[model samples]
Target: MSQDHSQDHSQDAGAALAEGRGRSAGARSSDQAPSLRPSLLDPLFAPARGLPGIGPKMAPMIERLLGTPERPARIIDLLFHLPQGGVARRLMGSISEAPPGEPVTVGVTVTGYRAPQAGPGKRPYRVLVEDPTGDITLVFFGMPAPRVEKMLPLGSHRYVTGRIDLWDGHRQMVHPSRIVDEAGFAALPAVEPVYGATEGLTSRAISKLAHAALDRLPVLPEWQDPAWLRQNGLPAFAEALRAEHKPDGPPPPVATDGTVPATPARRRLAYDELLASQLALALTRARSRRGPGRQNAGDGGLLGRIEAALPFALTGAQTRALGEIRADLGSDRRMLRLLQGDVGSGKTAVALLAMASAVEAGRQAALMAPTEILARQHHDRLTAMAGPLRLRLLTGRDRAAERRATLSDLAEGQVDIVVGTHALFQESVAFRDLGLAVVDEQHRFGVHQRLALGAKGQAVDILVMTATPIPRTLALTFFGDMDVSVLDEKPAGRRPIATRLVSTDRLDEVVAGLGRALQAGEQVYWICPLVAESEYVDLAAAEDRFADLQAEFGAVVGLIHGKMPGPEKDAAMERFAAGDTRILVATTVVEVGVDVAQATIMVIEHAERFGLAQLHQLRGRVGRGAKASTCLLLYRGPLGQVARARLEMMRETEDGFRIAEEDLRLRGEGEVLGTRQSGLAAFRLARLESDGDLLEVARDDARLVVERDPALRSERGRALRVLLYLFERDAAIRLLGAG
Candidate 1:
């Protein structure tokens, strides 16, 4: 499956450099040193010094918006800051034609003025104007009467525009939005672009800055295919940008424009961004292919042992995914694959199978989890499953002597499988013959961390797993570099969790149901939205709920919030798992990787406050065993339309992939990825919801381009490099060791 494309790349790079040298010589002879403009992508693009009117005071605000100080402001950033809406101005030659009771423009002559009652707290000036067809009043609440009179004296012709109403069947325009004379009217645009503003910023300021930045837009060669441009009826890049920044009216959907379909200018901008993304992914994929990988074929002995020890047989989907992983591990090419399965879909089992393969091959394998609890859970499960095969746990919480012994055994290749959190990647932990690295909850870790774990072995095969079933559109965009194995089927023995929606007002009823369930020897998870009640407002808190439930249910109710000490939290979880606690009141700390087969009832308080994926994950905590399960999504009264829809969607299906798509549609990509620090790409131009088709196109284009020119030595590729730098995907560039 591996190709030798690097040879072609090396030859092409040599030819490109030779041609560039000849051009450099010609430029020198012509007395031109060929502007070393840093490819318009140097770190300088981020320094506030490059932008006009961005003083020290404004720099901080820009930094706050961008969430970074290294990149301050740039001409391209401003151009990409798309407008949110547009304000269309109504134009009428005369007030006679202006429709009453609607926003209209009227040409009037100022005739008289009325001053507000002259007091400290009184309204200020009111000016009266009469047009040839009607009369209107302009009221300024704060302006001085003398100043207002001077500005619009008698017989002053002006075009006043605002909402007009009829009082006693007479046309009246209150608080005119614009008071423009003939000359001023000529300068006013019929339509104005309205941009989102921050605390100290105004839409006017944003428009001015955008205009200034647009002026600096360099006339570059078009990068899009001409055939695409003609067939799509898209304007040139510059024209599209101009239309977007100074839209005549509210910008139409991408379908109306024919180019990119999110926003007019943004869609064009997204195309460029997607091009850069694809280019970088292609380049990185190309470079990874260059790194020689070992074929670690393994005997089926250890795998058979682990599978035979399992209580249930593997589902068809799990078997298929495990087969895919085995095939990948046996291949000469490196195994950079993603294992995507729904929560409780037995992704961990698939990962275990893969790890067992490495172990059967006389090599070591390591599994990394995002959290200590998850790591410990994996360790416990793997230790039980790998008993016949022999595995070790190297978590941070392990005793010093035990950890030391485990490290020694790991270094000596005595440990078949090592399960831990990030402790596995620490310098102290060494694997004698590491063949595979399996990472759980892959999104929690960054690419660098993943790479560090992979680099632990001599080009180890990597199997990254995620319980969050990402929408296909986002999967291709984010995980395009890796082979994807989707576990779409749930195990046959798994029962559907009966989902119920309840209003928070019926808490007593829900609590009564929980009491009944607990009395019946069924375990319950009483999840809250927040860990603690805020002083400013009262909200259901996990601690408070634990206290309330403990009073009623006695010592059987346990609390496990993030704020608790690690040992205390682990104790609480242990109590719940061992059935010592019938009720576990907790926060989102148990959102992912916490598996309790006996917990059959889940009560999510203020479920509307949770995202669809989170709700799905919380619900997954139940229905693990054969017994029927129930999920009570207890939401507060008066849910917003979106929250209501989310609750309904959750109640309708247990399919994680469908829920994920709905979550994307409801919460958008930014919120879906969580806060800015999640290392998720916050695309300024591309909307994952709207531009999904473009994402698909970009992914395919990237794969195709890489197949054709792995090193980006082609002419089109040089231009694409500019795109990568522009979109901040330059991290992929460094993978080539080129820059």
Candidate 2:
């Protein structure tokens, strides 16, 4: 669908003006007339000033609590802010009848008073209250005496509510939360809603502010299907919000009371977020599908040569993945597929086959890596694999004359397969007939960079490869715009890595074992925790370890870290690969793209500090060789419960897919995807850990919805537009231009 450029320009202008309104509060000229208007989301997203009781003082606190720098908080954020638990204020009539350590409300009479030591540094005030059955002391430390006297005077009847505690055999309330007179006490809620509070902000303040904000909530049209709502026993949007914001004592179940059960309100909000994400992904997919693309069905001659050159036969999973890629490239629609495999799972070979197919079709193909080292690695591997087929490498580190020669060859169709870093997208680089673009470690590249590579050719088919095994739900959320294929099995001759957990306290023992392994001519990787030693603290550094190991093992040991020059790192890697360096002490820089088939032993120092996924990736480094590899997880003693469980899980299985699921369970989706910038969705209410089941439902529902309303022009689609806007997914709606 082609967007109306003029309307988009107008909308952009309106959004700018609406944003400017926050800075230029004094500028008001009704006669000037508003040429363009902000959407409903504009007002809903306006600063806290737009909400009642959210004055300048409270807005900053709200921002801090929400962890956002955006001036105003969105209404959707408030709706999704579900309570963790609740406090009950149900009345028990008398202090004696109230359960100990439980919150209760009671009507009592002020029978006496005891003033504490007055003046500076004094406790100040205390009040004595009595019911027909019992008397409870109210202690107020550091409170003004006059205020306490005025509020709870002698013989005054009042209702008091708070936690009842026994102090030195005396029943006392540290602070009587409510000490209202007869008339004022009648107006107090029998059951009050408690909210999460920040410093200088009490629960009562939040409740008051939330109630005021709810009052200003505009009635929105139903965005969920009526039948679905009825089947799920969910209330309307406003009703659900109201129900969730108000709770009775003892907290309700997650279903009904809105505080505990899977309340309709929480489900509604979760579904809204899911729908917005799905809609955006679907729209992006649709736009890409509409773009012009070429069908490049390559001859199988070059692919045959590459297959013959392989040391071992391709696994069934690898073959299936290659077939999928070939089918996608052969189709008219541009391929945007994610090739996910575990470390050493043969993703590189699969990528090479796909590129060979493109080359055989008389079209150019480019493989882009995340870093210069990885790019150089890929270049070397591809050059060897496609040497008989004549592939070329172009990287940033290339000499000036060499780069010119490579670019000219690329422009003149002398290069069939080009491998490089992001430099592949530079203007000087041109493809003779670029058909496919393969990106390694897809998470490292942004959407714009990936699109730029695709833009280098007219409808270049995109194939992204990642060593990280993404959970199914996150795959749908993050890479929903693309098709996905998993390389589930290792190729023939691949060995399973034997993982072991060891205490770091036995450093001497580990070093002795490494010495024996090195004597046997077995390659070793002595991974260190830090790149360098600090003055304030001591930790093993890769360089320091390299020197120490060299003193014992002679020149057989080498060091590599991020601080080393690229050429130096590459040389170190080459020496290790060529069996010259028996021991390579390095940082986590070798975690991802570094591949050495002979390295059999892997040691990770301070393994407790690494996440499950990182641990899995690091373990993968040693298992590539035919000799049975062992991953020694050198953890510090006294491991925490979670860390112990993570290490045990790693030792239990070598399944990357299962490890990915456990990682998601232990470390949430946010951390599992690396940083927030990994393009993982930031959920407001739904949690991938607790809400894993909901993700499947949401994914299916989203796919079904898009299938029915591709353009999102139906009534349900219109309602979904409100959902998109509500979740601040208006960008997805704008893509459709449905309005």
Candidate 3:
């Protein structure tokens, strides 16, 4: 976890895992333009060891705190280190007027000194100081006698600054933060900036390093729109960085409750960061569409065949989503689209139809799932409904002979559609005319992995699908490059899940009710909060619950969790699917894409511990069947406002989109569970809740600039390119060159 000293800079200062790890700079783009590095920023990108005081011993310490494991701390990283807050140390006229415990500077005469004895047991060297209002003791834990005598001769006047305390029946100053002569007093800041510190690195030391960084600030062309900056009354980027580091007066006022305020200077810096991110995404989107796209238009022959084979009709939302994807596939520009829906919202059907279109165009399509179970699930479902379209399943679990045959068939273009996990991206899994690349549960795969898969086929149309409905802010940050189509409606006959919150103290009553439901021949799902008993967590474990349920239900209850072997988990799921077991107790391993039509009960243990969106997903498991489904959210008592709000929202509505929006507002975007792995740009200064208004402005600005100047050759564009490098979006610039 990152420690914030003055304010939360987790988004800004946090070293994000590199955008697409394992991607070589040469491999990403075949651009003709010069390298993304413009000669002007070389000094900033230089190694931290090049800094005057940063020797070998100190460099590693700084890197550990500020740099990523992949890259050492650079001078540029130090340049972006904004102060956390300000510390005020205004000079007080006399010790009598100085407020106790508050920092104050005082002028005093060194009246006398008490040196430690020649041989002693932990004695401090004390110096006596006096002024017109009062006298005070200066305490130093350790000081060489000769040096101390030379510095503070008896009766010599000196300036001391530190927090004063009433000690041992007299006033005293412990280890003065600053002691200066008359000339040095004139240069001391009335208020100083406070920064986060690491071991062996003092706040004062960090402040000195930051000042050194500011001294090297280069004069550059303006990047922001002149009108926006003028209207906002914001300073230039360089001026803003300087002003934030050194306030002219007392520090900006924090809220009475101690929350950090978004001062104008801070907001300006925030805008710069947000603007950089928005611009990079806009550029990437533009680059993806720069070249002529492969128009894999089909005659709908294969789609018609698959549709005829389906057991049920398509939902209106799914049909509309399919239309959008079809249009993208037909267009001259490559299709980079995102398909979002709630759990069990039929995303796979749309994906299968899209793949059929690719096959009709004489091109093979591949669907990559994040897990083997989900991949196999896709293969099974599609195999039954795909009609005559040739389909194959590829996974690590495949036998060597089977795998070799599948690979040969895929390379020879005999397989029309292939479904698999990350193994699909293996070097050996070659495609003869790969057209569409569909990624299921895209949040689990990083951006680089997606790119690697896309690189497998030139101008391959990319379609990413996510079952978790993401909020608008997150969508913009993570999938800004893709056109989005949402499956907002469930198919007809899918009943609204009846959700209820119950206290865990009433577990016995709930169990008795489950017994009755079992007697009525209705299937039940008992979801626990954890897989095993953890010393740190308080929630009930699935294994313990499965044992208890097995004891009571006599072999009718089934169990599965993430920790179990694949075959064992498959067996348990098969038992539940086949109705051999009526009650299945499990952990969240069944959170996504697990389908059991006969199951009608969802008992989520400690639901208050889950996010509102997660609770909604778990609840979605049961409503797939025709029978009425009840989602019993069993939670412990003494809930906080946020957790209570989450549970209340789940009880009130089944709309995943609405739940997602509420989740964003209730917990902010950081704790949404998937953003970290989604490779979304995490905002350092911009709060999505409060700074949402700026997103549109920044996005619009970025679009206009990229549309007018793709290569960043214009005066303003050059400066914007610098902004890109500063925020580590140089990858986007490389995309422009490749285009």
Q: Which candidate ranks first by lDDT, i.e. highest?
A: 3
Model 2's number of clashes is: 8
Question: Across residues 701-729, which tens digit of lDDT does each residue of candidate 1 receive?
Answer: 77787788666668876666556545545
lDDT of 3 by residue, 1-739 (tens): 2332111222321112244321321112334233456666766666555667777677776776666644556665665666666756567879899878766789899999987766747777888998999999988776777777666688899888787899878999987767878988887786787666676666676677777777777776789988988999988888888887776767765544333567777777878877877787788777767767787768987788789879989999999999999999998899989999987788999999999988888898999998777888889998988889899999888899999999999999889999999999988889999999999887777666777788788789999998999887767766767789999888778888888999999999999998999999899888888898899997799999999988988899999998998778878888998899999999888888888898999999999888877787788889888899999999898998788989999989988999998988777776664554343434655666556667778878888998899888899998898887666665676666666
Task: Enumerate residue pairs that collide in model 3.
Answer: 11-684, 12-684
TM-score of candidate 2 relative to the true fold: 0.81
Expressed as tens digits, the lDDT of each residue in 327-366 for candidate 2 is 9988888888999998878899999899888888888899
Worst 10 residues of 2 by lDDT: 1-10
lDDT of 2 at 400: 98
lDDT of the candidates, in the order given: 0.73, 0.74, 0.79
Runs of candidate 2 with Cα error greater than 4 angstroms are: 1-38, 70-75, 90-197, 248-261, 528-557, 563-565, 579-582, 677-681
Q: What is the lDDT of candidate 1?
A: 0.73
Stretches of candidate 1 off by over 4 Å are 1-71, 92-179, 248-250, 253-264, 675-681
Which consecutive 10 residues in model 1 have the weakest lDDT in total? 2-11
Candidate 2: C-alpha RMSD to true structure equals 7.2
